[model samples]
Target: MKNVTVVGLGKIGLPLAAIFANCGHFHVYGADINKLVVDQVNQGISHVNNEPGLDELVAKAHQKKSLEATINTAEAVSKSDIVVVIVPVLTRENGQINYQYIDSAVEEIAKGIKMGTLVTFETTLPAGDTRNRFGKTIEKISGLTMGKDFFLSYSPERVYSNRIIKDLSSYPKVVSGYNKRSLELATDFYKKGLNCEILQVSTLESAEFTKVAECVYRDVNIALANELAIYANNLDINIMEVIKAANSEPYSNIHLPGVGVGGHCIPVYPYFFINNGMHEGLTTLSRKINDSMAEYAVELIEEIIGSLKDKTILILGLSFRGNVKEPTKSSTLLLIEALKERETTVCVDDPLFNPDEISKYGVIPFSNQLADQIDAIILQAYHDEYQKIDFSVFENCSLILDGRNVLNQREIENLGMKYLGIGIK
Candidate 1:
């Protein structure tokens, strides 16, 4: 059996390692700096919450003695025939690419890399970064020639958080490499390990650009929907109805509008394309339009009930997406800041986060006791728990703003509360 080391065993990396281990042809080593994460994985437990089927996969791999977790990345690489780097590449607030974590991972991999070892990167990167930035770094540190003494490949991770296991088997994997041999090795490895179809690209740059293009397309489409939603509001038309009617044509497709775009991929990946020295003006504009949506939501609330100062508003979900525990770049954060600027009191209620976690953002945690004091409620995320929530407890609530456009408007209005949705009259 081939030994495979997966670096940075976080959300995507841990599931990937478990999948590889259970494939019967590979024994996997998961490497991460977090000792708690390492210990949890070693005990056959998943640290990541809300991912379906990951817990069972990790447990089965552990029972078979095919998967192990460690903090020693170099030692894991020394024993492996293949290394897959899935570390994060973050974008700063100023739109600059932060390579600190991935650079450190490359440096560790270089220390123990041997000849003929296949090294692939699954992290999303700027186009040409797989060959120019990381490949050069490995060569400089290990004194090995890429595509000759060692193999280098790029295949972006294309799975969502909650459904990663399903997405791995469902979507066609994109693979590319520095040379012909590198491409062949990567294609063979993914086909056997992932049991998925492979779409091979000519070069590493093409594969890297493909992931960023997917993210940019979503950002731009959502921006268009947001812009149109505002226009429909002024015309006294419902934007949801407009989208449904317009999408009946076979040639037209439109995305939904929200308070703002959030989460790790959609909000951050656009900057990777913008700052790549490509002078992409439309991408930059779309980012600004999406970023301004949280403030726009604040304006909508004010138009319904004049003066937010000294009023208490409750936000439904802290997570960026529904039913997920992750809060990275969530739009509710922007909403809180805007409300704070207006001297309004913000209370947050998320079934995924406890009171201590909610208090970290400097907002009151909503409870049934505080329900009578709430003046307004904003449904930022439509978690399943909120679907059947009893709205009668909030006797003082004057308005319920459906940021996701998922709430029942007539039911809320019948409960003696005002119902407002994005672009809905």
Candidate 2:
């Protein structure tokens, strides 16, 4: 069995640690800055929200002595032959790439790592960051040559929070190394942990670009759907009908529109690409369009909520996407903030979140029995709980705004509820 250390205990890092630990081929040590997180992991408890079998895995690994978690970076690094960094690269308010966390992690790993260690980064960053920012720092700190003395690589984490358990093995892994040796090392290690196929790229930047491009492509397409949804509203046309007809051609693929885009990668990765290009004279129209979706959604929501200022409004779903506890850049929260600012009384419901937990948002928790009390409702996620909803449950709801087109317009409107759906009449 190989020895492995994973830095960061957040969404991407925790599951990755479990995969290696469960593989029966790795002695894993997980390191995180949070003491509570470390304690939980050591007890075989997972703090990653909505992750199944995680607590059991943690308990099992800890009991087997194959896995452990610690706050001491030096101790974990001292025992590990391979290190995986899964930190986040958040876009700053000024549209700049924040490399502070990444730089800090690199410095820590440099201090703790031994010679001939393999370091693989799973953080989303601009192309050339590993070589320019991390590579030089490691070289300076450890005074070791990267390709010869040690190995460095980049691999994007493709697991979405809701589908992480299934997707970890179902989706193809995209990987690249600083050099051929580094690439081979990562490919072999991942193949052991995952049931999925690994696609190797020549350069670290290629691997990084592949992930960023994938998310950006989705963002641009969703923005197009959002923009078209507005036009459909103006034309009094059911955009869903038109889109279904267009999709029947088999060549024209159209994405569904929502209140706005959410989740970590789609909203953040494009900034890394766009900001990096600013230094090289690049202006991207797609990024701008996607970024403006929140503002557009806010405006649309304002117009809808204007008439119901004094009425209680129910917003169903809080996560960035449906069925996940990840609230990073969730458009639903954005809509909540906008609605709160307009002095609208908001009642929120999500199967994944507790009412007491979200009480500070000046909203009440909506239960199955309470959905009928609201004057208006906003369906942000098409979670299964909401999908199987009976139209009679919302008989008292005067208005229903479906960001995800969750409700059937014919049924909902026929029940005396006015429906405003994305690309649907």
Report clash pairs, candidate 1: none
After TM-score superposition, the amount by which residue 353's alpha carbon in candidate 2 deviates from its true location, in angstroms, is: 2.5
| Model 1 clash number | 0
The lDDT of model 2 is: 0.79
User: On a 0 to 100 scale, what is the lDDT of residue 416 in model 2?
Assistant: 83
lDDT (Cα, tens digit) per residue for candidate 1, span 1-425: 89999999998999899999999989999999999999999999999898999999999999999999999999999999899999999988797989999999999999989999999999999998889998999999999999999999999998998999999998999999899999999998999999999999998999999999999999999999999998998998999999999999988788998889898899999888888775568888889888898899889889989999999999999999999898888999999999999999999999999999999999999988999999999999889899999899999999998999999999999999988887885
lDDT of 1: 0.93
Give the per-residue lDDT of model 2 (tens digit) for 1-425: 88999999888788889888988889999988889999988888888876776667777788898888998876788678899998777877676777777678778888888888989888887888877788888889989999888899998887777557678888888989998899988998889877679999999989888888888778777777777877897898888887788889978888877777777788788777777644342225655555565455545655655654666778888777777776677777777776776677778888888888667566788877776677787887667788787767765677778878767888787888777876565
Q: What lDDT does the true structure give each of the candidates?
A: 0.93, 0.79
- State each candidate's clash count: 0, 2
Model 1: residues >4 Å from true position, as ranges?
A: 278-280
TM-score of each: 0.98, 0.90
